[model samples]
Target: MFLKNAWYVAGWDSELVGDALLARRLLGTNVVFYRGEDGTPVALEDRCCHRLAPLSHGQREGNCVRCMYHGLLFDATGRCVDVPGQERISDKLRVRSYPLVERDHLLWIWMGEPSLADPAQIHDSHWHDAPGWTAERGGYIHYKSNVHLITDNLLDFSHLAFVHNKSIGTRKQGGVKPEVTFSEESVSVRFTTIEGAPPPFARQLSKLPDLVDRFNFYVWNIRGNYFAQDSVIAPPGDGYGSQSPLAMKLHTFIALTPADEGSSHYFWSTAHNDFTTDIVDVTRQLTAQVTAAFEEDRNIIEAQQRSIDASPGAPMIAIAADGTLLRIRRMVDGMAAAEQARPVEQTLVFQPAARV
Candidate 1:
């Protein structure tokens, strides 16, 4: 049920340090990750070739993993290199090794053809490391709901009216009809509120007039990436001083990776280009606010998942606000379908675990 050929964020780049083995289930496969001697990340199937023992529970000997169960050792390439008693290793004694790359503190893995794995295809989250931007540390979260449910929530911000009433959005802003546009790889939605009150979060950034102008834009891709740009400014004649923070800008980045049919992984962070403020303290406060906002969303999405489970046969009614969400669903469904229709020879099929 997942797009295996696509790149998925396995975890943080710093997570796999000093022979640490991070085992994660992505797209229904149990994969183990570790940092090699060269500090490069390596992903291998979690199950050991012999006795099906979990290699994640094994010890790392240099760049190879030694199965604590029977002393079977596997290299970073997932090839069986040593056996406790046997001198010769079978050519088939190996586990599937996935292509993994580390960039911008994120570890991305490719589960399909290793030949087609390209680092350029990975989403550019460079803003996390960009100059003049203060970004909070990246958050690696888990959700008990399907990836699509989370995507649906991210693609439609109209829920901000009722869902995030206390934090980031107002009723009028939620009611505003965004200009929705589609591209080959993503969908974009944008809207602006003139002479409207800023969200509660914006008030923390600066003392401004009761009324402000707000511009919001969001883009979502089928690979489960969401990029948002939000700007708020006080009226020009409001007599807000130069020292008074009158303008606020925020950028949010989110990436989703399906864990299985019932759960998903979330990688996110928020960055701002407010040089006038104390970036260190502002980032801390912003991180807390953004975390609270997402927690609210998490509660709602989990509740929706329970509701969906209760009424699996019922069809959801799409409203005018569902324009972007619906388009996202279409694109995801189309890509998944296309992947399934590809030639059989190009598909990766696994052999049965040999009983040793």
Candidate 2:
């Protein structure tokens, strides 16, 4: 159900420490992520070859992880380096190592063919390592709903009117139709509100006039599963920032990884270029507000998931506001279908507990 050839966010740059092992499930496979002694990121199958124990449960020995169940040591490359009781370690005694790269303060991993894993394919987000932008990252939430359900909720902004009425949206901005456009690599959904009042969260940045222009843009990379939302509120303007004095921008990047078919791991962060020296504190406050709004969404989405699970045959009726969501669903369905139809030799089926 996932696009295997793409890079998915394994964790934040700060999550993996030199002496700690982080275990995360991506695309239904359990994987362990850690930083080596030299501060390089490494990703390997979480399960050990011997006794099928989780490597993350074992302790780190030097640069390698020694299986706690049997004292088998595996290196960053997933090769069996030492076995306490055996004189000769079998070459087949190892786990699969995934290609991992650190970019934009996030660790991304590839789950498909090693030959096709390219670091250049990682998607970039605005305000990530930007000159004047301040970002608050390392925030995550687990959802009981499918990953696509969250994607559907994100692609359509109409829900913001009700879901986030107290924080970022008002009834005035919900009815506006987004100008949707697509390219070979990505899809853009944009909504513009002119002469509208700023939301509660934006008001915290600065004092503004009664009516301002608000712009919300969502850019989705179809193949890579990367999504970014750029929100700009400015003086009733020509475009982006014609009036620099009264402009504020908040950018959010969402990394969605399927923990399994029924659940997902969602990571997000917010950034802005409002205050220079105090930007970090400003971003932190903004992040907390957004987190509260996300909790509201989490409650709703999880309840919806429960309903779907209770009624397996229930059908959802899509409305006009669901245009972007439906298109994305169709694209995902097509990709999953194509992957299923491919020849067995062309696909690398990864079993979560299997040894390399």
Candidate 3:
């Protein structure tokens, strides 16, 4: 039930800093990623086309991979260039080479039909590297749960009341009605608490008075997980939804990537403007506090996964607040359904050549 023609975050660029073979299971496919001397990243099927040995366990020869099992050498493009004790190399002797693109310090891999992969469609996570902003302390966390469940959790933020009470949640967020909106490309659910007290931790450094305006928002796009927490504190009655030059502001960015059905990868970073140095500093340095909230998220999601594993078909009810989550689920399910039904004619046209 996965969409093949999409870009998934393989990993952070920092993970591949050195010449190392990174092994990861994405959407149930074993992929091995490594860097060529030219600093280009390459991804190929982890299994050798010959003896089914894992290339990750093999050695790198320049930009190529040597499957030590039978000494078959595959170039970065996944074409077999050499075979020990043999002079003939067949064009059929190659493993899949997935499309890989690096942008904004994140490595995005396309795991579906190679012909349909478009770098332009990779969702822009530009907030991390946008000019005039400071993106701090990018972090990664691994979770044991279906990626969809995590998306469901993010699509609806009402869980913060019980899950993140100690870290960033206040009772006020539980009562605010979220504005959910959608289009062909994305879905957003936003909650605004007018003149309500800010999260306990945020109040420490905020110049904002006891009663100020704040918002929590979540976004789901075609190919990536995204959400934000924003605060632009204007006095209770002065105004709302507009930024003031003197107002203190806050912004946090969170994104997710899937590894497999039973597990997933999480990537996150926080960014802020110059308006409130003190408040932003608290967010920057109290990353652990922020992390704790996510850990709380993990605890709940993993438990839910266990329940789902035991009874996958069990019905889960949706509430009024679930309008966005339902739409998000439908969007992904729709894309996957469409890909599954891709015409046979379109697929057969791309089939490999017959053996000579």
Candidate 4:
């Protein structure tokens, strides 16, 4: 699992509107999203305070969620407003509300201790407000795998050789020669394929600069612009056979948010310089491709989770191709450990929520 202090992509900005309840996950917590009467985005624990019924399953009344179970109403701040059929309810009664912000077409929520919620802490360097970059953003996918596994997959690039052979991999690109570098916060790998130069997909990208038939580039750009590309076989799990590509292109972003302990929601978006003129067509095409790729991954990850459940302490073998995966696992494990060791202090101050 990623650090609670770090920002996780929850959903797209367009999905968090209307008088409807939108359910999403962040930092392993389930949250229900809705808009207040003022049209600002608000999030609360999906489960109601009373009988734990999903508030998302109920109707949105103005800016509050009216629980269908017992007519309990919760405002944007999660303050309980009314208890139907009851003469009086405690003013202290409330459900947990999370601080949510929408930026760069992605919805971000603070799932850590409420006192630590700070928008400035979230990394927005690349996608927030950078010059010379044009981004076409959209919605995401829901996956059934552990969020960690999805992160592992994103951090490593070798899977392109086999799992994505039809879409992005070529026979000559099988040999490994990756440039690896890292920092306290991230790792990057870069690889160039000279022999199995370009796959079929590369033909479409031929119009781009610096791309040639003899030299095809495969870069795995990871955390906060930490870029890396290498040949690495992802750890194998039970249930799904790796076949068929679901995603459209090679440069798609894969973000994972833990829906719970056993399941995760996968959010993906692609940005490229070539499709600026026809972003809508490009986005639609990319979304369809990525959605298919996600399905392929879903089958495998779910099966792997089941296997892990059955065997609590099973050891697995890894090879040279797994160096990046190992590094990713170590990084994640280290982050988790560090977070546990030095918990961030939470301090709450009154600040008006940003209007969407």
Candidate 5:
């Protein structure tokens, strides 16, 4: 149901603290996140082996966590270091630790085999740390639907005409041609001929008084599930691709991490080169408006999930605009199927319970 070897966004860097435990479920597994004494992010299986108590319920002691149930202490590597009642610690007494890497103001975790958890395999979000780009830290959204639904909503922008009409989209965006480009590891959906009155977000951000030319670009990296959309608007000339300085661009970063089979944790961040403290208040207001528009999306997708659940065998059709979405689904399903077909090694060997 999920790509286990891929890197999933656990949470924003600002969301985790050295003293607090952030309990979250990823890829149908219960995991806990926190910062160590050196301020390094750490991820571990939330279940404690002794009584199966959630380690997140315990208190943080230095870089280790002390289970509240029996006062068992666990280190950052998920190793049981101390037990008040006993001095002998078995080597097998430990919780599974996930490899975590902190970059681009986000914490990413590898939920697969420990040996394959290489930090170098993580994807990069250049805009998050690039110079001259002001990165706005948009917070996460809890979606009560499958992760695929959210990805579908993002890859296809045709729905924006009606779904986000009052926010960042207009009716003019519906009938435009989407140029779909594909590669082995990435897919891009581009709309280069969008020309019409500025949407609410473009109007506020661009401060343009008349109709404008626009360019919308959406890209999906298949491996890490990092999705991005670039919206550019300007006067009736070439789009941002022509290096037009008059164009106003907003880059939105979105990544999805499965909380189970039916729910997900949405991580978002946006960067805009146009930063004006004079209009900072306006930007703040625009942020709230955009968040509300996304909530509108949340409602519709959740309703769709419910409908599907109610009618398990209902038939649904896809239109021409779903080209990119179909490609993404194919890629993801292939990855999951391949992972399932591979043999899993048994970490513990049993010889008829030691001939008992």
Candidate 6:
């Protein structure tokens, strides 16, 4: 339920390449993506005109996607270029094209009004662009819950004690209560963990001795560079427990984009000042670990959704730990309401038309 008007990370920079038709879901719509002859990324409705087959399954032919079912070719602009059997078709038959841009090793597509698509609005963290910090970029598992849940989880740092204890929490630190603060667009939670000596989860991070200490964890909604200890925790379902404290020292950038009613795309990048020389390798290992954690979350969230669907009328209960989740739900609901009240004519766009 984040702002649809804003730019969201779709895929890693390396994922997009020459004439490859990538099918991805963004803002509840199925989009077909490909690179043009000029090496620019383009997006269009996935559905083909000849048949309803997804253009993603079609062949990439010199910057155009040729429908596999009917051999109809469409250019990056969504114009029907080649109709194998027919000579001519009306312009109305053209597919809808969306604006796309590449930045900071990521692919961003406009899912709202094309005219409001502002590439500059896309949130980019300073560490990602800084000279000393090495970046490891990739994506994570798709979740069944709404995108808002993911954002809520990211914004909250208290779950580390119980849910992610094995990975990020120390038994001694669990008793420490956190002071939480919230703003219109972001939330900040701060707490302290014992300094010196690695906790149980830190065993895996024996290679990094400098990171063992009391840490700070901070989550901001808008866009800024700030460091906090790595006490942030995510819900645990599959017995993975939490990640080690040292892992949190490696800064992570996460972008959650809605795929549809019950799906989402999570793109992330990890960076750190210490592991600059081996950031890529460290990222590869960390990505695998982080992905496992997400998989654990996916199973639980999907099960939760199934339960909610089965008992729509039943009352739900919550505890103190659920505060962040509740706040996030409220924010999402509010955004949805605001969007609904506005006329469709005013939808956000990537590129606005010139004023008369």
TM-score of each: 0.90, 0.92, 0.88, 0.76, 0.92, 0.78
Q: Candidate 5 lDDT, tens digit per residue, 257-341?
A: 9898799998888776663323556557767776878898899999999999999999879777776678778988987898888
TM-score of 4: 0.76
lDDT of each: 0.76, 0.80, 0.74, 0.60, 0.78, 0.62
> Across residues 1-356, which tens digit of lDDT does each residue of candidate 1 receive?
67767777788876878978888998899998887676667788999988999999988887777878998998877889999889899978888888777777778787766666667877777788888777775687899999889888776767888899998878987777778888877778777777788788767755556787776777766653445454435554442222235466677878888889999899887787663443447777877888988999999999999999999889988877776677678888888888778764453443211100
12, model 4: CA deviation in Å? 1.2
Per-residue lDDT tens digits for candidate 3, residues 204-256, read 64566687777556566655555555645556665545565535554666666
lDDT of 4: 0.60
lDDT of residue 318 for candidate 5: 78
Off by over 4 Å in 4: 25-28, 85-89, 125-136, 204-251, 275-296, 306-312, 342-353
Clash tally for model 1: 0
Q: After superposition, how far is residue 221 of candidate 3 from its true place, in Å?
A: 0.5
Off by over 4 Å in 5: 242-246, 275-280, 345-356
lDDT leader? 2
Please give, for residues 66-112, the per-residue lDDT of candidate 6 as tens digits: 88997888887788878877887777567777766677677766665
- RMSD in Å for model 1: 4.8
lDDT of 4 at 115: 65
**Candidate order, lDDT descending:** 2, 5, 1, 3, 6, 4
